[model samples]
Target: MLTRLDLMAGAFRAGAALALSEPEIRGLGRLVRQGDVCFDIGAAYGMYTYPLAALVGPGGQVHSFEPLPNPFRLLAAGRRASGAERIRVNNAALGPAPGRELMTLPYRFGLPIHGWAHLRTGQRRPGRPISFSSTRTLKVEVRGVDEYCEDHGIDRVAFMKVDVEGFEARVLEGAARTIDSHRPSLLLEIEDRHLDKYGMTSADLADPLRERGYLMYAWHRGRWARVNSVTTARRNYLFAAQGGL
Candidate 1:
């Protein structure tokens, strides 16, 4: 007999499988390896965590960070259900330093709020505030990747996936040392509205990686789409350090 949560988890997994094309999944699979150290920043409900854990195998390790209470609990539950020893769950938001910050979650599934606020074109409204969860500011711990790896004795990080709402720039700033030292591949989400909220643009995100000798390519329609900063929303960009070790 399975619990309702288990059923929901199963449904979520199934939906993800159906939603994501095979090539996209394969591309994500290719970014990691056995015994490698991977980071899933802003891991919402373990959508990528579980699959990544399995991809990395028992020898590799995954550190998933999520700050929101609801999603954090879901990530913990997913980790437990996965029974994968290599996945370590952390409840925190990664930024340039360790401190407290406020995060605004969506009131509805597709209703964008905060910096990333934008109307979901072609999507029907789910309803009013009653149909959506209330928005609140919660204090969350923020840390740099370099500090985290140094303290944990993780010498090399193979891949880092970041989806920190509108704070991607800050998150990247905090991981400068780590990026310089480990030269890990990065999978970053970039939304124009979100960047605008922080007074940044897609160019700001791409310029740094380009300066560091990283090659940028977008994930789109089940394949890697070579593109520039102007057209990033089709999918997240993948940055691999030139001559990565």
Candidate 2:
């Protein structure tokens, strides 16, 4: 939860509105439809939520998940300000399993970049140009996407965007049923460094998608190319289901 002081400071310090860049928005528009439901996992300040709501339209709904308080507050504020009623923001994390988990919010010079917060038990790589300290932590609720959909009576999801730092695999795991049944298009960030923190590699993150017959593509030089493997570098990959939406 965010305190009054944090909300005030964040609203002013947040500066420009957080939304997907032009290329990303265009890329997403290709996958989602006007009446489709979508999910924006690790949604830091509605970067994709507002845009998704617009893409999906009022008849559609965009469920955004953001665990950290600072960004969660901003996310909710942005949703309200945008008047995107179809966008529902959730202040919780999602993982393979539903339970309480510890999330780390790193601070540089005592300021937090809400987007950088991640869920990991292990420490980051040693010695960077600037030292980042995990000065704050919050125990957040984790839910499975399959369970969430079932409870909410959501039969289909046109697209699901996952960017949970390094736990992208876990998010996919929780959404197994949804993937198998609904065949939603997946746009998830593949960052090997974050996966390494949890003893996972980039390839491990793509296993389920591969098993589900998802054709993987990475954006290269402003265009997407089919990829059999992803590197440790930070990038988003689009997984299109075979013979499905």
Candidate 3:
């Protein structure tokens, strides 16, 4: 059983793993260009969102989405300070369909952990380490990437950063059309420990992009190395279509 501190460390490691290094910034520069549209799905406090916003510039647009209310408020408020006027923050989660889903919020000192709130899959292992507060739940609105793009008249998305805990599969599942047609490069966080709650493997998350003619790569020591197989060795993966890469 993991303690609350252990869970916090896990969350910290997850963030550190997702952050782009100097070379990674350069590598992503090619895929994420100025004046191009981008998305930061599962954006918590705009970590990836602000970076995407910076790369896209004023001419480009970065759409950021966070389901939890606490993070959503922070994300929206940061827009003014970020002054990356092209960014639009939304308080909704992107899933396979449009509906409402209850998210079980993790807690530390009785406050909701910013990024630990995940969709209630009910598969949470019984007698799991730290107890999650049942009352600390929020029903978040869910939308599909395909529908959101269509509704917004967005034609081409330059890149997307998806780190929705274990729900990456469903998000991409809804994005099949978008990935097929627009061919945007993707940065994803895939961890089986989290995915297992939803009965998914890392391969299941990467397969969607693979089927769309995308290749996976891992950032190591300031260089991008092509990954031949899908594994959890690297928590963050860059999936790019040939056209974008």
Q: Sorted on lDDT, highest at the top, how do the candidates line up?
A: 2, 3, 1
lDDT score at residue 242, model 1, on the 0-100 scale: 69
Off by over 4 Å in 2: 1-22, 121-130, 221-223, 232-234
lDDT of 3 by residue, 112-133 (tens): 6665567874355422255555
1-245 in candidate 2: lDDT tens per residue? 64343343244333322332424544665688889999999988776776677668669999999998878999998777666678889999998877888887778887986656777644454212336754588799898899899889999988999988777888888898899888898998887756766777778888767887898977655455678888654378889887643
TM-score of 2: 0.84
TM-score of each candidate? 0.80, 0.84, 0.84
* Clash list (residue pairs), candidate 3: none
- Judging by lDDT against the true structure, name the best candidate: 2
**Residue pair clashes in candidate 1:** 35-60
Q: By TM-score, how accurate is candidate 1?
A: 0.80
Candidate 3 local accuracy as lDDT? 0.76
Model 3 TM: 0.84
In candidate 1, stretches whose alpha carbon ends up further than 4 angstroms from where it belongs are 1-17, 20-23, 106-134, 243-245
Q: Tens-digit lDDT track for model 1 on 185-228?
A: 99888766566656667888888888988888765665665665
The per-prediction tally of clashing pairs is 1, 0, 0
Candidate closer to the true structure by TM-score (higher is better), 2 or 3? 2
RMSD to truth, every model? 6.8, 6.4, 7.7
